[model samples]
Target: MVFSKKRSFTMLAALLMVSLLLSACSGSKTDSSTAAETDKASDSKTLTIMAETSSHADAFKSIIPDFEEKYGVKVNVVEMPYDQYQQHLKLKFISDQAEFDLAYVPIGWVPEFQLADYITPIATEQAKLDELELDDFPGIDNAYFGADKQLYFLPYMNETHGILYRTDLFEDAAEKKAFQDKYGYELQPPQTMQQYKDIAEFFTRPDENLYGVTLMGENSILSGFGFYNRLFNYGGDLYDSNYKQQFNNEAGLNALNDFKELFQYASPAAKQYGWSDASSEFLQGRSAMAEMATTVAQMAQDPNQSTIVGKVGFTAIPANDANTSDIKRFYLPYGFVMTKNSDNQEAAFQWLEFATSQEMMEKAAPVGNIPARTSALTGKLASEYSFYKPHADIMNSFRLETLPLIPEGSTITGEILPNAVVKYMFGERSAEDALKEAATEFDELMKSRGY
Candidate 1:
């Protein structure tokens, strides 16, 4: 699933504060109903879950039957579009509606959920942790819960960007010779940002209705993610160690300029592209390359949806001049968050454990769900999946460290900074000016939140 903007921290904090005040003056009317539901859950054999209708849902469907047979519980899963899932969940939570027992949460949403008390710590039922094989998920517990050291969600999938390119184009003898003659290097997957640009420009054939690369030019969270991935790879940080804004540096400028250059080589509709648009561009053989999540590897190879089925290749995103690593990738782990007010915490946790178990993840691996569990990621399952090795290697070696893990961190990364990228993309502001605007907003947010 693609990245989507989280609720703004300023708004979330204000809403939560109001919720607290309201509950203080008049007790929660749902409390008694919630207790009743808890008792009902213990006797009933049904549970509800809300999740994104992506590959994850596909895999969930396959394994859900087994879980249901084992627990004798019927689970009704409500699948929603990725863009709507966050806001939908927020509405349900704020309204004190226990419409679902568990939710598939993006890691970036954990802090917001925590602030609203929408999710309970996984530690509440520590005994279940052992049975789920907690140690199997290396770096996951830390990656998702390191900020407050409270495990609020069970890791389901870890997503990171990778280059999906047309192998047939790279291997064409005539094109290869021409590329080498013109660029002085073998035509292959790019290892550096400059090489990436050169290749994009080289393959650009606009008259033929084809272009070089697919640009995530939409002024939304995907655009933000697209920009920050490059910004970080270019040695830029959203903020310094002390949490002050620092994206107005040379690295940010270079990254932005490089990103802008790709638009010239991108499709005419590049300005409207998001993650799905980019994926479609590569799958339909419209562009030479696309930067997308590793999860797309399966989709790119599927004969039904892709014309480039056997011609696609996967690799890490290119590195900037200052960065030593050939591929520096940022990862966001998706997990299952059990609502704090769930009447059936026990049953919900059981479902949570079942969903994230190594066994279930192994089953999902073939269908494009990248496992967060070290055992699952490195086990025979990954080896059997043709596209998993390179992604696994990138995950192990080149994980990009992102912004500080403060409560407002997701808001900055997912919203404020992204809005700046949108501004620059639309010619409303220069790169430096846009980042400066974001920096000012970031500082004010952090200060207001008592950072």
Candidate 2:
């Protein structure tokens, strides 16, 4: 009886083991199917976007809820400070660890990103291109192309440097007449550097409440670009086709001297000023005029930030010379790019298309950014925004010239020239001495990079 019972127990154990195996197989199949469904749901659509901290981004986020409701996908927006965003992005792309799927890049930085193989070309979607009206975008769609002609980015915001003036201060007919009498022209916003200088000088009353022009005089890429914009307008180029430093010439010296001459009338703190300081002083009614980015139009009109709301006027950057033929114009374009490390290329492209689309422009234009799309500018969207109309008019009137689209353009403008220009501006060195010294340093830097 004991042997029979032990044999039955052994058989019972074997039967239980077989039943467990069958259950395990069924569970494995169910798990596999659940995982496949989860992956399919995840693959439906999602985009992670990195954007700069601009009023534009705020407007974008405000409308994202609507975007999600219309489209089936969700968008995650990551806003970053302007200064640190580029470095953060570079780190993300280099490590192939970017959490974000798309980024808003300064149009000039496209080359650097492309050189690192971080960004994918927009032309990757030929079918999407056929559906989108790319020609509606202003400036150059090809601005993001590499030397080999690969489209790596798309312009999200088309910006230009323009004059932002206090209309309340200049509205007096007598003051306007006096300005015209002194300068031999109407007291309109200047079209030439000489006229700009005259207006700056005319408006300056250091002992009174107001001063003359203020600019971004701090040593940074923006400052360097500002100086070069003037220099280029004055017929100076940083490099020839051979990539040699040619800014040590007379045109450069003249540009430097022109910049220096403004110190007599500019605010005493101009040396410490960047875009923020300049914008603040101008908005606070501390300065008569300022050369500023087009985005300042919103700030100038905002009742919250500006004391001179609805009393601000806009105009193009002053030409270098009196002759229209000799005038040189340059504007920097800012845009969006997709990183190569992004796993969701299609999603990223869709987000880029949407952000740069007419719909987004309608939301963004009211916030004071110059929309990249011509349709957005000409459409009811721009007309509804009282402040953007003048800026749009100015942008449309010009062909929009820009510096050469090269990889080293940012470094040259930001690192090399800004320091040299500041040193000259502060009387630390003469313009010639500063330019000569800077040229030597820049040449060495380029050589080290094997440029």
Candidate 1, 143-220: lDDT as tens digits: 345345777778788777778888899999999999999999999988877898899999899888779988787877
RMSD of 2: 10.6
Model 2 Cα lDDT, one tens digit per residue, 50-142: 777787767666666766676766776666678867777777777876755677777877877888787888754567875557778766655
**CA-only RMSD, every prediction:** 10.6, 10.6
lDDT measured at residue 56 in model 2 versus the true structure, 0 to 100 = 70
Q: What is the alpha-carbon lDDT of model 2 when measured against the actual structure?
A: 0.74
Q: What clash count does candidate 1 reach?
A: 0
Off by over 4 Å in 1: 1-43, 124-127, 143-148, 321-328, 402-407
Q: Report every candidate's CA lDDT.
A: 0.75, 0.74
